[model samples]
Target: MLKRKIEIRLRPDGEIEAEVKGFKGKKCTDYIAFLEELLEAETIDSNYRAEYYEQEVLLKDENKVLESIEVIPESILKASNKK
Candidate 1:
């Protein structure tokens, strides 16, 4: 997984400033593009580092491991309901 830190600072002039660190390549800029779009503001400035494009892909596999499980009865759910 890629690790990075994003800092947002609100200035006295009502301007918001953002800084991204530990990310490299176009990854940092590309990732933050959504923020600018969400806020409906143009990017005034940006700085990029080289580590942003690298990320580890985790392999997730599911295996059925069945074991005896006990479940609480439906009467408990009705008893806990306030309405």
Candidate 2:
């Protein structure tokens, strides 16, 4: 499983900085958009780490696989049907 993490720090000078970890390529940008918008922050600079180039990394073990799945609660589905 791939883990995603966001690190936020407030500097003594009242400047806020955030670092997105465990996300590769442009995907990392998605995690920070909401915070940036809420703070009305203008990006002064962006540095892409080495991991960004490897958007997805597969393990060496042939049996290992990653898949995307979505689950919706039955109650929510029933309620939506009644609308």
Candidate 3:
């Protein structure tokens, strides 16, 4: 799993600052978009390293599994792509 963390700092002057860590690739932009919309804040600047463009993904195939009941793995059930 990609580890993600966000920190918020509220200054005495009512300005807010957010720090996002541990996100890779366009994931960082996705994270920032959600946070900015949630807080209605404008991003003044961003700092990113080469690692920021790398993404972490996990894939699993569920056709093979031992089950006692009609159980489905959470990952398969909650897959973002479904028709």
Candidate 4:
């Protein structure tokens, strides 16, 4: 399971900004709606990070974020693509 997080900031002008992380694809949208209703404020603007476009690939009892990354060689990647 992804370790999801939401960082919400209350601006000086009382504008609310929330950055939702670790939720793949459009999963963050549900939280946005919840915030809007909870705060009784209409969202005037929104932005998505690159992660927002990625769909979650689930593996049972697996978390995708590795404790360490193992770099793959370009040659290996190219060879795999040919198959």
Per-residue CA lDDT of model 2 for 1-83, tens digit only, reads 45878787778996788877877656777766766887777666667665555545446787453542333446867999999
In the order shown, the candidates' Cα RMSDs to the true structure are: 16.5, 11.8, 13.0, 8.3
Q: Model 4 over residues 1-83: C-alpha lDDT tens digits?
A: 55788788999998988878877666777888888888889889999766665565545578553332233456867999999
Model 4 alpha-carbon drift over 4 Å, by segment: 58-83
lDDT of 1 by residue, 40-61 (tens): 6778766543344444332457
- Evaluate model 1: give its lDDT: 0.58
Candidate 1 C-alpha RMSD relative to the actual structure = 16.5
Which portions of model 1 miss their true places by more than 4 Å? 49-83
- Prediction 2 global C-alpha lDDT: 0.66
Order of models, best TM-score first: 4, 3, 2, 1
Q: Assess every candidate by TM-score.
A: 0.47, 0.56, 0.57, 0.62
Using TM-score as the measure, name the better of candidate 3 and candidate 4.
Answer: 4
Return whichever of 2 and 4 wins on TM-score.
Answer: 4
Instruction: Give the least accurate 10-residue stretch of model 3, judged by summed lDDT.
Output: 64-73
What lDDT score is found at residue 34 in candidate 1? 71
Q: Give candidate 2's error at residue 17 in angstroms.
A: 1.4
